[model samples]
Structures are given as C-alpha cells and as structure tokens.
Target: MKTTIFTFHPDLKNGSRINASLAKAASEASFEVRDVYRLYPDFKIDVTAEQTVLEASDRIVLQFPIYWYQTPALLKQWFDAVLEYGWAYGSTGNALRGKEVLLVASFGAGAEDYQLDGRFHTTVEEVLKPIATIQYHTGLLFLEPFITTGTLNLSDEGLNEQVEKYLNILSAE
Candidate 1:
C-alpha cells in the first residue's frame, strides 16, 4: 500500500524531538513524508495539491503532537481546505472512501493523565472525536491510533523504541 505521512508540528526542525525523529524515520523507511508546516508556513495550503496527494495514497497518516488537547492549527486548515464538499463528502464526494487514516499523536503528559479520572479527566479517544466525525463524513476508514505519551521526559532509548514501533505501524499492510 502507498502510505503518505503528513506531519503538522509548528517548529519541527528546531523545537521538536519526538515528532522530528519520527518523521525522519518514516522518510528513511521510504514512505512519502510531507512536513505540512514547512510546506505551508504561512498557512496557505494548496488545496489541489493536497487533495491530489491524498487521492493517490492508500494510507494517510496524520502525525502531530497534541497541543492543548487539539490538533495543530494548520492541520485543521488542511482539513477545511483539502477535504471539500462534492470531493471528499456529499453525494459525489467519494475521493477518500475506503482509504485508511491513522493518527499518530504524541502527548507531553503521561498515559495515566488521559484516564477517565486522570489529570485531564479524559481519554485520548475523546480528544480525537472530531477526527472520528471527519472519518464518518468523508468515508475514510479510521484505524487504531498510534499514541506516544510523556514526550516531555521520554528518554533517548524510549524515543528509539517509539520510532521502531512507528515504523512497524507504517510498514504493516
């Protein structure tokens, strides 16, 4: 399957460790990796280009860090601009139908903090409900998410392990 990874970190090159490393690993594994933030630094997404890429890929991976329990601003914009009416939804919008979407998210807090009664008082699945709605609307198949928690203190060994796991997910058919 043809897999494309779209990374949405605001400052991946300078201010990120986990996301940067993950993107690098995916790229090295021969998967197409697009740094959305780098592609549209001013937030001016090329709707046609984005949609074209999506149409050509079988698996779409959205990689980002959970910020304030939300996706990065550019990703929200990408969804709005790329997944349009009569193209990705509505009666004639079956461009993404049957395509798989995987969300790879990293959290600064520990996994325990995302429990029902944890610090956030919510689960990661709850945080990603909006994407589920998108999947329903766009006819995209939502796969089990790949989550990495406690990024703030993840050791080098832990990050290496996470990269290996991420590659495994990307390589899976």
Candidate 2:
C-alpha cells in the first residue's frame, strides 16, 4: 500500500528533535514524507496537490507535535483548505472513504500529566477528539494514534524506540 506521512513542524530542521527524527526514520524507510511547513512557509496550500496525494495513498499519516493541545497552525490551515466539502465530506463526497488515517503526534508533557486528575486534566483521546471527528465525517477509517509524551527530554535511544514503533504501526495492515 502506498503510504504518505504529512509532517507539520514550523521549524523542523532546527526547532525540533523527536519530530525530526521520526520524520527521518519514515523517510529513510521509503515512505513519502511531506514536510509541510518546509513546502509551504506562507501557509498557502495547494488543495489539488494535497487532495491528489491523499487520494493516491492507501494510508495517510498526520505527524506533528502538539501545540497548546492542538495541531500546529499550518496543519489547521491545510485541513481547512484541502479538506473541501464537496470533495471530502459533502453528500457527493466520498474520495477519502475506505482510506486509513493515522495520527502520529508528540506531547511536551508526560503521559501521566494527561489524566483526569493530572496537570492537563484530560486524556489524549479528549485532546484529539477533533481529529477523530474529521475522520468520522470524511468516511476515513481512523487508526489508533501513536503518541509519545514527555518529548522535552527524551533520550536518543528513547526517541529511536518510539520511531521504530511508529514505523511498525504504519507498516501494519
């Protein structure tokens, strides 16, 4: 199956560690990894091109680091611009149906900090509900997300371990 991972990081080359490593692993494995921020610094997404990429792929992966409990600004813009009503979710839209959508995200805080009684007072599922809703509306099959928390201080080995898991998940049926 053809798979594509859309990576959204504002400054991936310099500002990120774990996310960059993840992208590199996917790329090295021969997966199509689109560094969205690098491609569209102005946030002007080419809807046709993006939709084409999505349509051609059997699996679509959205890779990013959580910011303020949400996706980066450019990713949000891509969703708004590329996921059009008539093509993605309207009555006549079914292009994304049967496709698998996966989320690969990282969090600055530890997993323990996302529990109900913890610092964030929420679960990862709750934090990512909006993305799930998008899949529901678009008829895409939502796969369980791959998330690594406590990204602020992950060791090289720890990050590589997570990357291996990510590669495994994306490779699975």
Candidate 3:
C-alpha cells in the first residue's frame, strides 16, 4: 500500500531534533514525506493538491511534535482547509472513506507525566482524542498512535530506536 506522511514542524529544518530525524528516516526509506510548513509558509494550502495526494495513498501519517498539548497552527489550518465540507465530511463527502490515518507525535514530557494522576493529569491518548475524533466525521480509520514521550531528554540511541519503531509501523500491512 502507498503511504504518505505529512510532517508538520514549523522549524523542522532547524529547531526540531526528533521530528527532523524521523522525517529523514522516512525519506531515506523511500516514503513520500511532505514538509507541510515548508510547502505552505504562507499557510495557503492547496486543497486540491492535498486531497489528490490523500486520495492516492492508502495510509496517511501525520507526524509532528506536540506543542501546547496540541498540533501546530498550520496543521490545524490544513485540517480546516483540506478536509472540506463536501469532500471530507458532508453527506456527499466520502472521498476519504476507507482510508487510514496514523498520528505520530512527540512529547517533551515523559510518559509518566501523562497519566491520570500524573503531571498533566491526562494520558497521551486522551490528549489526542480531539484529533482522533476526525474519523467519526470522515470515515478515516484511526490507527493507534505512535508516541515518543520525554523528547526533551531523548538520547541519540533512543531517537534511533524510535525511528526504527516508526519505520516498522509504516512497513506493516
């Protein structure tokens, strides 16, 4: 199956460490990776182009670092713009039906901090619930997310291991 990854990092080429590495690995493995921020610096997404790519791919992976406990601004914009009424969610919107969406997120805090009584008082899955709910509206199958916690202190070896895990998921049927 054809899998396409949309990476949403505002400073992926510079500031990001984990996200950059992940994208690099995916690209090296011959996956179609689109750097969304770099593609639309002005935040003017080409809905037609994005929808075309999504339609062609069997799996759509959204890779990004969790910022403020949510996705970056541009990603939200992409969702609002690309997932239109008639094409993504209305009664006639079935263009994305049967497609699978996987969210790969990196969190600065450790996994321990995302529990019921943890620092954030919430789980990683809980934090991602809003985004996952997209499936109910669009018919896109929501896959269990791949999350890497404690990104702020992840070692090179750990990052490499995470990359391997991410690639394995992508390679899975």
> lDDT, candidate 1, residue 123?
98
Q: After superposition, how far is residue 137 of candidate 3 from its true place, in Å?
A: 0.6
Q: Give the Cα error of residue 7 in candidate 1, in Å.
A: 0.3
lDDT of 3 by residue, 1-173 (tens): 99999999999989778999999999999999999999999999999999999999999999998988899999999999999999998999999999999999999999999999999999899889999999999999999899999999999999999999999999998
lDDT of each: 0.95, 0.92, 0.95
Given candidate 3, what's the lDDT at residue 44?
A: 96
* Predicted candidate 1 versus true structure: per-residue lDDT over 25-97, tens digit per residue: 9999999999999999999999999999999999999999999999999999998899999999999999999
The alpha-carbon deviation from the true structure for residue 32 of candidate 2, after best TM-score superposition, in angstroms, is 0.3
For model 1, the stretches where C-alpha displacement exceeds 4 angstroms are none
The list of candidate 3 runs beyond 4 A from truth reads none
Clashing pairs in 2: none
Which residue pairs come into collision in candidate 3? none
Clashes of 1: 0
Over 4 Å off in model 2, which ranges? Answer: none
Q: Measured by TM-score, how close is model 1 to the native structure?
A: 0.98
RMSD of each candidate relative to the true structure: 0.7, 0.8, 0.7
Candidate 2 per-residue lDDT over residues 43-100, each given as its tens digit:
9899999999999999999999999999999999999999999899989988999999
27 Cα displacement, candidate 2 (Å): 0.6
